[model samples]
Target: MTILQPQVGHETLELLTNVLIGNGFSIGISSQFNYSSLVELCDLNIIDKKLFEELETSNFEFVMKTLVNADKLDKIYNRTDSTFLHAYGRIKRSLIEAIGKIHPEKYEIDLSDNYVLNKTMVRHSKRIFSTNYDMLLYWMILEDKKHVDFFGRSHNKDGTLRFTPNRESEKQVFHLHGALHLYLNDGYIEKLNTSDHLANHSSIVELIKEMIELGRMPLFISEGNGEEKKKSILNNEYLNFCYKSLEDLEGSITVFGHSLDNEVDSHIIHALNNAKKLSRVNYCIYTEGKSEPVIQLEMSRITYLFSGKEVVFYDSESIRNNMRVIEFYV
Candidate 1:
């Protein structure tokens, strides 16, 4: 049985899915969801276009870091400037809106071939772990109509589905990096679900937009390195649980969509290294062809990371089929 752990690589969104545009990747996205689109948002939202341009990249994580540093620099210099803070708020709002608009409505996707996706991506997996913060995978669960099996039933008192693992539930999904519907409240992670959409919103995307506008930014961890990501994960119980789950597997695991680079994802590598019983890994890789040398270098890194373990490389096509979460329908 394969425990499918899907994550984005440090760059270019190589994990077969590019819900959010990755820097330096040849991701196919509509004009509405590209970097220029984000710049348009910055202008349309009345955010300082100069400030946005200064960031020099479309990656939200990098932008957040620069804003954070700007805020810190203000304090260090004993200067009182609300400029970055205001821009920061506007950017966060824009970021959430960007995702809301980019996230496809269910009807936009052709769910006709869900069976092929289920047979290949879900049926054989013991557990499914995803690192994407978008709602694509969640939509896939909605398509399957077995969210009860996919999402655990443990609810906290606030009606949010708590990540409480139970013995009877063999099938489970963990949003390891948190999603737009998840937010931190009173030290606990609360997941907004279908009911939230029905009661107060037109769609999940709108619900997410409303939540972020109301200052409930979902727990998105876009920190650069594993240590930074780990620190962010440690702050929330649900996220920590997801990260730690990596070390508990005892059989073969199929790592899809994630490169697990030691520098950016060392925490994950550390966890995998701890899974002593994990005998085999069915790792996915992009077909080299023209990029053979680069792919080989990556394989060497992967090999070095999983030393002494049986790591088998497979073509990216397997997981690429499941990446149908987005563009395939179009």
Candidate 2:
């Protein structure tokens, strides 16, 4: 009953780029709009060009603070047509598109083998919890004709939601953070129409510009304490859902791309720690060998507090070249 949760970010993109380029997608796709930056970034990485080190001083607390203080993000978004949120969404969509265009068959097979097939054989339900605001996962899952099983039917803030992908009719995803495709109207979370792609309309861009002129908010985390833990992210539903998840006797839970930097998310670490006490809880932290230092540091910190179970570090290069997510089950 292994539970694998892959983080979808730079690490994912890096490996995926190799997969795409190897499959014969054009490097600089002129047909794709606003693809210049994506092509440039992908080109530089694929060509083995040197990339500047990101400011190493940045840490979880720094980013958490920025997310909580929406005003800071607002200010940044105001000046530029591109809000941090928009950029984040764009990256997610582009990565999925790039992957879909290149090895669509491989992508579908891997997902099915890794999650759905594994769950059926093990007799343990599959549950996917993600913090990404993008719909890439949704799109991928839909293509497979699978729906998520959220824990509870309660729409209350205090109610907890747990899910078994096999029991989707009973439960569904409990989006802790707001989703990009969801809009808050009249204090309710409603799904936006799929047709509203905002194709160069710049309404968001103009709206953001006006916000910046009026000193509006930023949509991302730049730096500060994630004090919004109690009311916002750590609300009742989140806490209870986490508790329920930890209680489940599922086997190893593979954490893919998440940084586990949020102070509010310390609860997840705590839950994992507790799970390890009851059974063997193995961690598969994936990363390019070069970025092992950061993941190692995080592992050390969390492991120090949780010494009851085994924590394994799986490097990407070791598996990336010959890796298929499906291989984990077989």
Candidate 3:
């Protein structure tokens, strides 16, 4: 399927990916994440045992939403508990540590597959917004030798690389949810400047280890529901920037590799609806063989969301079979 923008000159498309982008080279968050260590690290047994149990069975995202609710309750009672606030700090560090352990090393990656994936993305889109925290997307973009500056090269006052997406460079990948290499400090989202010094797999591993040692976790949406996730996204400077940018997208928009699940991803659906100039939406449905009830329901919700606009559905496997090379007619 070829996508063409309504406007005459807009060529390259707006592409978005979630954790389910492919069969996926990254661990991709489907595997059960152990939150037990987080409790131990945070010493929540003495502080709040119930909180630890709830978060134990869930990822940090759900735990964060729990904390947010706790914060609101504290606000209502007019009591400011610093210890409750500080527990998140300890849990966050442990969560980052778990991510570090779960993530695939650079040496474990298939560079050939990434190079092909990179070529496919370059062929279809210029601006790519990804919610994945893994380095697969980063590695694929790095495969483009001429555009390694996707995260920008300019340094900031805090000794971290500035994340200015250079559109002229094309093939810019923006991390909406944050990556394993990105860390949060004083509300400023920072990137681990691995593009320059990363010569080999061993070096990448070393840098990641050093980053973990410094107590920096990925800047991610920790909430369970859409509203909670929305609040978290709006609170962060970079995340808000990414969300608002998507909300304003015009013409043809391709939501590739995202389930667009109405339960947890209602915020993303709303973002697409607010794109006033959205003439057509090219949404990819990841169907293995046949359509399931859940997939059909997801499609219905999307169609209802964009009642007046044209919606195009594509089999995700077809795109993957095509080696990520999406043909766009602009």
Candidate 4:
């Protein structure tokens, strides 16, 4: 397979960051007054009048410090509850948009059929995993008639199967986190399956408003240790499919767009580390600035467990163009 490296541009990166933050807000992971939400809530006065200046200023600072730490965020909130709600809301919104809007049209990549074809070949890769909640990759695979198994929650609930029907044997895309469009209410994870609603919900504004008014709540996951452990792949079929796929695949694994942020997901990385068929794995992160804490942790985990394997980082921009000419040798 020929190697292709696509470079990500500053504008493209900015758009991606904006999209992630925006989606995070809509999901209540960040404060309802975060940047993108502010654009929506500000005009509607969902933000309190007296706190308008404070909210707006805090939003600006949130963008400035990158919200990478707690002390920086503590500047705005006096309590941990406020900090959690605000930051979580923003993160949720940012992730939603990142998965939704990342594409050539938004990033100036030539995502024509040819480019898409090239990218699809790369993704036809063995044992792929994503922590994202969006269905963009699934949609792309469907469009291409390529088969990739998803090992994530079919719905974010217990005792429910998360299976992708008609998946072929050669390729896989596993989702570690529960998908946003999929909801779990009564031991069932229901798909809000709609072409238009997935991308543009006409009532999203109202829905977000309602969720914001509801106050700090964990809509993403049910509380308690028992419920938390149930969500793990060790018990979930969809996620275990990914684990087995990683064990069976005969080449190196590559990752993109994931931040290595959660400990539960560290299981996947460790599994890949222990895989017999895999010798060395590569990581293609979105930015070089994240080299110290985020990327370093990924490496530390892998090296500590599998010293023989290698972890390499690539700038997203440099590899963005490789899609245009990818001839998958792997």
TM-scores across all candidates? Answer: 0.68, 0.43, 0.68, 0.46
TM-score of 4: 0.46
- List candidate 1 segments past 4 Å from native: 1-88, 112-120, 145-158, 318-330
Candidate 1 steric clashes: 1
Higher-lDDT candidate of 2 and 4: 4
lDDT by residue (151-197, candidate 3, tens digit) is 44465554566556443554445566656666665555666666555
The TM-score that candidate 2 achieves is: 0.43
lDDT of 4 by residue, 214-261 (tens): 321112211113223234445544445544555554556555544333
lDDT of 2 by residue, 23-140 (tens): 0011111122223222233322321212111322122223223333544667766754434444333433433344233322223343443333322211221444444433344444
1-330 per-residue lDDT for model 1 (tens digits): 122434423211323221111211112112323332444654334445555455444445456557778889999998897777787787777777667665665455434453244333443344666655666556656655533322344564555664554434555566766777777666566667786455866778878778767656677665456776777777777777776666676666667657676787787777777888877766766563646677777777788898968876765554555445433432
Which candidate number maximizes lDDT?
1
**Total clashing pairs in model 3:** 1
Candidate 3 has its poorest 10 consecutive residues by lDDT at 3-12
Model 2, runs deviating above 4 Å: 1-125, 149-174, 193-227, 234-249, 262-264, 274-278, 286-299, 317-330
3 or 4, greater by TM-score: 3
Candidate 4 regions off by >4 Å? Answer: 1-127, 150-167, 183-231, 261-264, 285-305, 312-315, 327-330
